[model samples]
Target: MTVALMWEARAVEGRGADLLAWVRQQPLADEPLRRDVLRAPQDRVLVITWWDAPYDADLPELPEPDAELVTRAVHRWRFEALPEH
Candidate 1:
């Protein structure tokens, strides 16, 4: 009964790389995840994360608030990982 989370957030123009670099620096990724969250900025970014655990997956950590990369359009999604199908 593993769960996966999808993290979506908007970044300032040209700040996607910085945002991503910050994400890559989190302790969350240190956990055993199926894959690192996907990141790309099209004027913003739609981050996709996949993980498997005995229970719900924890959301990845965000960078410091001081960075001012937060977007009003931020959102998080959770899903249950299904059996091979």
Candidate 2:
């Protein structure tokens, strides 16, 4: 099975670049099959990591940034990839 973990956060005001840099500097306990970092309007940053594990498996995820750097708590989600038709 394959699992994809998503972590999203919104930076405070004009600190989007700083927040993105911080996320890039973070290291996971284990490397994933693949990873991606994305950004959007409103200073939102999103990271997706794909791993070869069960849906309920315990996987390493990105940690939350400092409170002062973000507008609110981070959002996270996990999904099990389905077969490609």
Candidate 3:
């Protein structure tokens, strides 16, 4: 299994119930959902996803503003993950 570290940051101009509705509609649109998203207060969100197959997670193929957010989100950092010992 493989896991991808995803991240996103959005401006404060648009924050509403519509945002939630839009996000929900998107998960199963073009591809099956395989992600976990975490929010940082009101301006930033991070996502981590797992794949059973090899994937190149470029976001240009997704929705406009969201794809742009993913493209610039930056996903090349490394960190230690503690395993159960």
Worst 10 residues of 1 by lDDT: 58-67
Candidate 2 local lDDT, 19-80, one digit each (tens): 99999999999999999999999999999999999999999999989999999999999999
List the candidate 1 regions with Cα displacement exceeding 4 Å. 41-43, 46-51, 54-67
How much lDDT does each candidate structure score?
0.60, 0.97, 0.43
lDDT of 1 by residue, 1-85 (tens): 6666666666676777777766666666345455455665464555455555555545564434333775554676677877896
The top-ranked prediction according to lDDT is 2
Error (Å) of candidate 2 at residue 10 is 0.3
Best by TM-score: 2
Cα lDDT for residue 15, candidate 1: 78
Worst lDDT window (10 residues) for model 2?
55-64
Deviation in Å, model 1, residue 5 alpha carbon: 1.4
lDDT of 3 at 1: 31
Cα TM-score per model: 0.64, 0.98, 0.45
lDDT of 3 by residue, 23-51 (tens): 44555333423666556555454545444
Q: How accurate is candidate 2 locally (lDDT)?
A: 0.97
